[model samples]
Each structure stands twice: as C-alpha cells, then as structure tokens.
Target: MNILTFDVEDWFHLLDHKSTKSEKVWLNYESRIHSNMERIYKILDNTNQKATFFCLGWVAKTYPEIIRKIIDKGHEIGSHSHLHQLVYEQTPEIFKKDLECSIKTIEDICGQKVIYYRAPGFSITKKNIWAFEIMHELGIKIDCSIFPSKRSHGGFPSFKNQEPVIVSYNGITLKELPINYYTILNKPIIYSGGGYFRLFPYYLINKWSKNSKYVMTYFHPRDFDKNQPIISDLSLARKFKSYVGLSGAATKLETWLNNDQFLDVSTADQKINWNEVPVVKL
Candidate 1:
C-alpha cells in the first residue's frame, strides 16, 4: 500500500539549523505555511485523496484555523513535537515534556486524542531507541519515525524491516510505518519523500512504486513552496538539498496523487492484518 503523509511544519522548521531552531527566531522568517498548505489542500481536493498530517504544536497554537480546516476536510492529525527539536539531542525528560505539550496542543485545538507521532527529521535512531518507549508511554499508538536507512539527523538503519511491522522495543510494542526504500546498485535508496523524492525523477519513482508492496511517504509544507526565501546560514550542501527540484515538486506530487491510490495512515492501519505482519524486535 502506498500511504500519504505530510510533516506539517513550515519552511523554517529545518532541524539542526540555528536560525530556525527555536520559536524565538522562527518569526524572523516569513510565515508561508498558510499559502503552502493551500497548495496541498488544492491538490488533495482535486485528487479527492486523504492524508495523515503530523503537525507541530507551535503551528496549531499559532494557526488554529489550519488544524480546524484539516479536521473539517476529513484528514487525520498527529503530533510532530512542540518545538521541532531532535529527539536524540534532548534528554528523555525534556523530550517527554515537549511531546506532552505537542500532544496537548493539538488535542486542545481539535478535541481529538493524539495517538500518532513522527519525530523531527526522523530522529529516533538506535542511540535513542528509548524514544519508542517514551512515545508509547505518552499514548502514541502509531509511529512513523523510523527511517530504515541512513539519514543526516535521524535514521534507524539497524531496524531491518522496511514495511509496516510490530516494533517491539523495551518490552513495549507499537505499530511502525517505517520509511521504505528502493534498492539501487545494492544500496537502499529512498525516493518516496523529502530530498530523496525531489531528487529522483518521476519515471524511477513510478518504477519503484510498482516494485514495492508497501510505501510510506513523508512530505513537508516547504516541498511545495518554491518561492520561500533562503536561510543563508545553511551549508552549501544543505542549501542544495533543501531547495533542489522545488519548481516541479508540486506537479510531481499532483501526478503521483493522480496516478496511485494513496491511503491515510489510519486507513492503512485498519486494512492491515497486524497479526500477520513481521515483528521487529528492537
């Protein structure tokens, strides 16, 4: 199943960067989430598709209308943390506090219990596998934080299964929809979302989608906002990774939405026979 999900943060929410690190400096950048999210809504409306959105508490708190519109449009919402901090960088106590704040923020806005989560930049690697237990304790029932391959900020390469699996960690089990990859030249290459999705061509993406049985996609508001200003402090490599293929990404996403039947996380969960899936003991 090809599942559609969006990391509902603004362009400046780029993790690990000093300028966009905290809410104090976040205001320095232009607030483009409103317009960018409009693009997403238009595309989804045209395609008549549903998606799961992992949103920042700051966003929901700052822009309650966005959260309300999401619910009104019949989309599922999940927590993407409060301040957009990396899970591994913060202490477990701090992480729990931030997670609780985020969950409470969104829950307060929509009056819906928050049970789904995704760390900023998928920052729940082996070093911070404790995050799973913490998330479980915080009432997160489904997690999409596993990258399944090497990533700059966060990835759980040691977690082998690419598809949906019962993630067993620290005596706690949770449903995991890890990012799946396409094998190219004996290497696991991800082309389903973010920089990878923008870098790869549609032909290869189509081929890869046809080849794989389960696909989980993670997109951001910035992916569709091509006119966003550049954060000059970023390194040359990060600059390129962040802005490359912006011009055509929206069209590509539109094409993908029109081509394939993508389901939201909740729907995908109901369709899966969890008992039959592989259990990855972390």
Candidate 2:
C-alpha cells in the first residue's frame, strides 16, 4: 500500500532553528501556507487523490478555514503538534500540554477526534520513546514519528523495523508506522520524504517503490514552492538541502500521483491486519 501524507506548516517552520522558533517571530514572516497548500490541493484534486494532512495547531488556529477545506475535500487531518516543537527537546509534561493543545485546537475546528500524529521533524527518537505512552493516553491510535534510520535532527537508529508495528506501553497499544527506507550496501537509507524526495532521482524512487511492500511518502509545502524567499542566515548546507531540487518537486509529485494509488494514513491503518504485525514493548 502507498500512504500519502503532508506535513502542514508554513514556509517559515524551519526545524531546529533558533531564529524561527518563537511564535512571535513566526508572526513576523509572511504566511505562505494557504497559497502553497492550494497548489497541493489542486494537484491532488486533478489526480483524484486523498491524503493525510498532519497540521500544526498554530496553522489551524491561524487559518481555520484551511482545516475546514481539507476536511470538506475528504482528506484526513492529523496533528503535527502545536508550535512545531521537537518531542526529544520536551519533558513529558510539556509534551503532553502541547499535544493536548494541538488536539483541542484541531478538534475544535474540524469537530472530529484527532487520532493520528506525526512529530515535527520525526523527533520521537530513542530518547523519547516515552512519547508513545503519552500519545496513547491522549487516545491517539497511530503514530508516524519514528524515522527508522539516523537523521540529523531526530531519528531512531535503534529501531529495528521500518514497517508498521504495534507498540505496547502499560495497557495501551499504538501502531507505529515508521518512515520507509531502502537498503544500500546492506545499510538502510531514507528516500521517502522531505529533502530526500527532492534530492533523489525519480528512477531510484521508482525502483524503491516497486521493491517495497508498503511505502509512505511525505512532502511539505515548501518542497513545491520554488519561488519562496531563501533564508539568508541559514548555513550553506542547510540552504542547499532546503532549496536544491525545488523546481522539479511539483512535477515529480504529479508524476507519482498519476501513476500510483494512494490512501491517507488513517485509512491505511484501518486496512492493515494489526494482529499480524509485530509488537514492540516500551
């Protein structure tokens, strides 16, 4: 199965950056989420595809109509956390508060229970496995926060499986759908989302998709917005990673939409045989 997802945040929601971290500073930047998301909506509409949008609570609060529009079009809505903070950087108490705030905000706008989550930057690494317990308490049924391979910001290198698995914490169980990866020289490499989706050639992606039994592809609004203003103060490497393949991203996505069948994460979760999936004890 192919699961299509989008991390719904504005252009300025750069991960791990001190300058753009604050809510006040976010207010200073021009909001491009609406227009950029419209571009995404057009693409999905033309292709008759439905996706899961993991929206930041801040975005929902700022643009409630956008959340309504996404739901109106029959797409799933999932939480991307409030304020876009990394889970590893937060205490359990702080994380719970932020999660509750995000769920409440999204639920208030859409009038539906928020049951799916994807951490900002995939930040629920080994250091924060406790996050699963908290999410279970919050009634989340599935989590897509564990990036199975090492990442610069937050990744779970100790995680053994890339496929969907059931995680048991206390008495609650939550399904973890780690980001997809492919083996290279016997080592797993991620090409399913973000900069990797932009950086890798389409042929390699096609090969990986054909080989994998289940693939979850993720993208952000910034990926398709090549005209976005470059952040001048970012490190050279960061600048390149963020902006290198912008021009071709939209075309690549359109190609995939035309060729493949995709379902939103929640629907995919429902279709899976959870009893047959491996269980991980936390």
Query: All models: lDDT?
Result: 0.92, 0.89
Per-candidate TM-scores read: 0.98, 0.97
Weakest ten-residue segment in model 2 by summed lDDT: 12-21
For model 2 the local lDDT of residue 44 reads 98
Worst 10 residues of 1 by lDDT: 13-22
Backbone clashes under 3 angstroms, per model: 0, 0
Query: After superposition, which runs of candidate 2 have C-alpha atoms over 4 Å from their true positions?
Result: none
Q: Over the stretch 1-282, how does candidate 1's per-residue lDDT look in tens digits? A: 999999999988887478656698777677999999999999999999999999999999999999999999999999999999999898999999999999999999999999999999899989988888899999999999999888889898888889999989879999999999988898999999998889999999989998999999999989988899888888888888899999899999999999989999999999999999999887
What TM-score does model 2 achieve against the real structure? Answer: 0.97
RMSD of each: 0.8, 1.0
